[model samples]
Target: MLHRFDSFLASRRRFLQVSAGFGVSLMLPALEGRAAERRGAERATSLITLWMNGGPSQLETWDPHPGTVIGGPTRAIDTSVPGLQIAADLPRMAERMKHLSVIRSLTSKEGDHERGTYFVKTGYRPDPTVTHPAIGAVVPYQLGTDHLEIPAYVSLGGGEWPGRGGYLGDQHDAFRIFEPGNSIQNLRARVSDKRQERRLSGLDVVSQTFRAQRQVQAERSLHGQTIDKALRMMSSEQLEAFEVDQESEATLQRYGDSSFGRGCLVARRLIETGVRSVEVTLSGFDSHANNFETQTARCEQLDPAFASLLDDLRERDLYDSTIILCLGEFGRTPRINGLEGRDHWPGGFSCVVGGGGLKSGQVIGATDPEGEQTSPVDPVPVQNLYATILQQLNIDPAEELITPIGRPLAICEGSLIPKLLVDAG
Candidate 1:
């Protein structure tokens, strides 16, 4: 009974849909958006990045090179580790020096803000062709943990960040949450028990029908995977873990009052409960004008919450297994700029790394007299840092992520920073 005209039209639609299902931009954009490229994720690795988005100045943080004409008001004080000094504002970190390291010579070739951020997040530099995957995406897609009910990566940002699970597909996108809502937004189902179950069942039927009727190899394969993951999320009885308020009263108080504190508390609980990655962002640090006043208050908010998070992890015996990184896209200028605030300085910045069984109490590299410039031997490129993170978690730093069109794009282009290797064989 099928008419030739109707059949031809249906075929054409199927072809167009299938073509759209795979895009070259799926891999690193420079890789011609090659499809199917995947990098191996380290299953045991877990990271909690305390991102201070925009830019935090090196003059006020980990790399305080006082005594230089270029250096500002903040003076460097010695840490527990000999021959090392950091800014006065980071008092807690100075005393707790045995657990941290400073990579003061981090320099980036890309001066533009957006592009620099992109390069740091992805191992490769920004290219026009392929959109790269953030480590958040790289986590669940390659390194899935066992018995985790919630999504692998959970990112808590007050507003939208230029975050993406590029080339890895939309399935790897983070479960985003913000404040006022407190817990994750849109994660709570609207319907009651009966309706929720019924709706899920209906979804299953529709998904099954679509797959059976429209099976075009790769498209069918992708859809099938999404459905399977969705069903697991739906069926999990432990989804309540996302709502950490289920814990005792004292547990919540331990993390403190601010949203960052709450976010860190949630991260601690998530990692303990088995989510692979959690990224917590604290905003307003891009103080381009009133630098000192802004950073002092910002650090005050950051200090207690950060210290407590680390302390809580150890108290729960999770410290050794979890890694914490506090970073920003770039550092502010050493010379108080024309605006009275430190402007963007990609020349030298500092990032803090701790736990995950890596070597601690180490200062990996150095910057010049005022932390204004990177010393030649101590240059820490963005790729090198990414590679070091991958290595610490037992991922093969040099592994090739296969692109969709069969080209292998380099994942971690640099070797792991030697000093941070803990159990590396």
Candidate 2:
């Protein structure tokens, strides 16, 4: 059965609507615990996920099998690293390949969009028995929020499934922003300061009465907690982190004039402001038809933003302290269908992960050159990827968290891919 907190999150949209008078409706988590105590000098403090909403074709993106029958029209281009070639569409990312590690054999059992998304983001297949927390939620929960007034977990350009707090509670749910660089709504009260003060006072009185009627469950109520966080965020200086327009025209142009680009820029600012995890979503990758054209368009928007993010992180000296993950739920099938498109394939795919003290310029696995086999050469399970990420963040993968009903679950069940780590061989 779903927990009470789960029910609360289910009705969050209605709750926010009812509480709009508070001038803050973003469900910010009530962060508990002290700042993260680093276990290693090279551990990453934050994560930036460039989430490709739909499945992107590995043949057209990371694992280009140029000149092959299933390679389609996509060509491969050489990168800064010798023998490392990405899709020709992503020339910018290719140039910055020295800072990335391409995993060409990411495999999963979930092929449906929703299921795959949950699995990739949470490192677990869908379990009707329990809702699992996303890696974003797990990061801040393990590392603590570091007293960040802004939500430690933020999602830009909300997708079908933004990261959820799951058993971690609604407080860890991602604060959603539909548009990057846009001003947050209802941040300031419409009425005068005196009026707002009087309103809050009245609210407290009503809350006290409500609590009195349900004394047993009053302490568990998130109403008051949500209000307190809303007010704090309203006055936080960190709010400026969302203003991607504050960047110079040159910087803006470098990142491109797309929402995804702006979101990437905002993600950098949030990371700089100490937010633990930020995800920038770019949709339209579900190319079940006209695969080549669709992929090219998506890459046009992704290339600049992704490359610029790397440039800025390195420039600000934040690269070593930040983990970057660029991938989708799964990958497109190697076999081109009748519509000149590719279908979903969970067997063998590609994802790029680097930074956060990870070894760079390395390719972990490979798919068949002929693209005939459904499976890749050395499959990296989704859980293992999660394990590697948790280890890099100084979070123990073996650590267990208790569900609301007292069921214990480990943070991650997979083992670390030692080659990905800088210190590991």
Candidate 3:
């Protein structure tokens, strides 16, 4: 059910293909009514998800069990916060830990890649009965503005399964931007305005005839709105948000020359322009073999970009208004395998959440010295994490949203983790 927008910008030389392709408006009026709820209110305005695609090793990350059998030679370094240490590989992030907090005892049972990804992203297991909207999809659907010229949810470097709109409809699907700083293909038209108008007019006639014959009033309305949204996106003056080149070379270098860095830069720009949610994914953390080597390489890519993003955001005074979340589907096992790698372990993991009015430099929970669950009362489930995120965003996790089929669904079906909030004790 993953949808890609890359080919949607394919050539328009063939009139039939061109005519069939686009819609300018996205009329999800269902979404418009669902403004962010005020319960458990926080003043956050945007979210940037640093999505560690594969399961990252908690031992090598925020919850390193140094000097233990499972520690695996990954030394812990002191962070800005006294007595708090993270993997030595993330030195830059270590210095930035004052704005960050770690939940070291997140637990889940979904180990398979796709299943785990779905659970983490949607706060629900995959269900054939109902395709759930991802957090990214939900935020924009609930908080997006009518006058927004930019797509509310944007994905940078998200591979095949970038999450979907589910019952939210195709309109809420993330606008996937494969190249962070570069312009998206086909955003500008090849033909003159007059020619384009003629083509659209012809398509309108055909659409009207089809609507008259099929009498699919709802479908027609949705389609028309989609077209309108597409059209608006193409001509948006705010489209400059995608241009990271506008940033100075020094700034770009600070974030690093990597795609992930560029993506973070683009994410910041998008947030400044009022995008509700943006996800920047870093792949290759699934270290079933050669765990240390692979993890070190991955951290080399993540540390600079993430640390730079936090610094720049704070420098610009955007930190309080934005939530920066860094996580993966699960975590690597505490035991190193025969191949010197770690297998997937959803039982105990770690995630870093910062800004957005969250209390900083605090560890929420922990694991035993043997890298096992410390207590049944300690583990934070995915649902609770999602609930905390929503609450911090000024959204009510308990508020129900009606699915297209008339079924009521809460924005997030989990209890709030009060310790994660700035105002909480």
Leading candidate by TM-score: 2
Candidate 2: list runs displaced more than 4 Å: 1-11, 27-44, 216-221
Give a tens-digit lDDT track for model 3, residues 1-425: 33333333232223224543342322222222212221122323888999998899988878887899989899999999888999999999999898889898887879888888888888988877787889988887777554466678889985656857778866677777877889765565567778778878887898788787877773734556666656767766567888886789999998888889999999888776667789999889999999999999989989999999998778777788788999999998888999999998888789999887888887878877685553424789989988998888878888888888899988788888888876778
- CA error at residue 136 for candidate 2, angstroms: 0.8
Instruction: Give Cα distance to truth, residue 56, candidate 2, Å.
Output: 0.6
Best by lDDT: 2
Candidate 1, residue 182: the lDDT equals 54
State in Å the error of residue 405, model 1: 2.2
Model 2 TM-score (2 dp): 0.94
Least accurate stretch of 10 residues (summed lDDT) in model 2?
Answer: 31-40
Give lDDT per model, in order: 0.65, 0.86, 0.78
Ranking by TM-score: 2, 3, 1
